[model samples]
Target chain A: MDVETLVLVHQLYGAQSHYIDEGRATEWAHTFTPDGEFHSPSYPAPVVGTAALAKFAEDFAAQPGVTRHVLTNLHVTPADDGLTARAYLQIVRTLPDSPPELLRLTTITDHLVRHAGTWRIRRRTVRRDDTKENR
Target chain B: MDVETLVLVHQLYGAQSHYIDEGRATEWAHTFTPDGEFHSPSYPAPVVGTAALAKFAEDFAAQPGVTRHVLTNLHVTPADDGLTARAYLQIVRTLPDSPPELLRLTTITDHLVRHAGTWRIRRRTVRRDDTKENR
Candidate 1:
């Protein structure tokens, strides 16, 4: 990818993490395409569509205690004949209360597309590092 | 930040992981510059020079049981006035014995430079996900 494209993707990744960490659920949902999909080991089925995505983010934000998602090691590659890109990232969640705790370590695979001149996630799959299936 | 540079960096990352996983310690050491430096939370001080680097790789390989390093989410950017690049990546170790187990989750920050038309790591620092200091 060109420098501009790489920077834009990085920005998208950062914004997605920030919105969720800050409890901006609606904005977090906006990081996805209108018909985006999200799947996690914690969820039995994938969440699809903007409304469902919003609800998912909102529920996560409403949970007790504060959470910060630390994202790193992002690998981006072209996919779907160049129409979309695939990104693999690692996420670490920290909870600070009483004693600060490391909550989870997960890998996220994202399928992104340039929609209306902006990069948006079309699909995201979360794999927990502690899970047997993930290994 | 051009496509060529990005692709080369990606290749270097893949080769490094493959060399270690496949027990090619010397080759793994060669992925670094002659005077490369490596630091990790497990080490009290950084390991420098090709000979020391090879020893480190050999020691890691001598550990009991088979280990595979799963690297993902690589973010690369220019550094040192374009003479070097900085890459951040996440690593997960998987061991397959009685059953598959996820052993560790860590983030690696690498400084790379081009030498004789090949990209080599100048420095690498590892941070563990579960550490309080890392968060």
Candidate 2:
């Protein structure tokens, strides 16, 4: 990856975390493509398209307490003749309280494509580290 | 990074995980440089040098139950004039037995250097997702 690509991917990763943590559901949904899909272990099926994706984000943000999503260990690689890229990311959720407990650890595999000169997630699958059902 | 470099880093990452998961302590330690250091939130200080690194690997292998360190979401960037690279990796530990439970989730930041034609980790610091002290 070139320095520019690396920086762009980093920025995208950071933006996703920031939007989600701040409960900006619309902004978070905008990070994905129009027909993007998000699959999590917590959900039986994936949330697809902008409308469903926005709804999912809104529901998550409505939960009790504040969450700080800490993302790290991002690996980005090109795929399918450079039109798309695959990235692996780690997410650590922190609950703000008296002690600030760590709530969850999840790994995300993102399939991103360049849409309108910017990279947007086409598909994102999340696997919880504490679960055995999803690898 | 070039395609060759990206592939090389991925191979190195895979090798380290495979060796450690299979209890190949010597091989796992060999993935590091002679003066490499491994630091984790679980330890008070960093484990330095090849001998110490080997010891630490052996100790981890002797733990109860089997552990599969699933590594993903790796982002590698050039550092120190391209002679070294900084990579971020996520590790999920899965235990074997009835139900096969998920053990832990940790993130690793590795500093790798090209030594004698191969990439080796010079320093690796681990941060647990469930921790508050080590940010």
Candidate 3:
């Protein structure tokens, strides 16, 4: 992936926090491709399709006034097929001015594909080696 | 961050899925530093410190026979402060040989600090603008 393409996708990823922080649920739903998928073991399988994705946002909006996503240790590998990435993510949910409580997460690993004219999550899998809890 | 560190960290991140999938709860607890933390808005705040974090793992182990984390679209900003990363993560859970289901996640944005000797979460946040539901 070109630096700019990577940069835009990266920016979209960062905006996840802003989406919840602002409670802009619809805007939050726009981050993925219409057919893009979302995965998290805490729940079930991948959420595919825009309609279901929108439902996901509505549910989150009902709780946690504001949520932020932090990622670090980003290592991207540009491959002939796609860009391979490895990152560590920490999620925090805040209520107005409260001290954010952390939601536990271990690591993020993936393969991204450039589809049509935009980059989409062709296939992604998040793996964790260890886990922790918050007080 | 050097390519090796990036690779190692990525490998660690990818292991998140394996940790849960294999039900190696303790191994899943080792991903962070003694003071490493995890963040997810879905929760209350950041899970700082190993002890509290370990509790987090135990809770997750109670369910979800196996969990996988998938990260995509990683862009790293090597700042003087540290390595800043942005990524999108998807998690899946499987029961024995059952089909994995998707969990809702938006994006991961973070700032990682290289601790005294190794890389730690430093600070992490997960953001979501959109969400999806699984059938």
Clash counts for the predictions, in order: 7, 5, 63
lDDT of 2 at A71: 59
Residue-level lDDT of model 1, residues B61-124, one tens digit each, is 7765445566666778778744344343444443432333456677787888876678888888
Poorly placed runs, candidate 3 (over 4 Å): A1-135, B96-98, B129-135
lDDT of 3 by residue, A8-89 (tens): 5555455554564455666665655577676766557787766777778777767734554556666677867877666776
Which residue pairs collide, candidate 2? A74-B74, A74-B75, A75-B74, A75-B75, A88-B73
DockQ, prediction 3: 0.03
State the C-alpha lDDT per candidate: 0.70, 0.70, 0.60
lDDT of 2 by residue, A5-81 (tens): 75677688779867877889998998898999998876889899989988888888887677676654455767773
Which ten-residue region of model 2 chain A has the weakest summed lDDT? Answer: A83-92
The Cα error of candidate 2 at residue A38, in Å, is 0.6
| TM-score of chain B, candidates 1 onward in order | 0.87, 0.86, 0.73
List model 3 lDDT by residue over B19-104, tens digit each: 74566766665666667667877688788876777677777767746666656545565767777666666655678978766554
Superior by lDDT: candidate 1 or candidate 2: 1
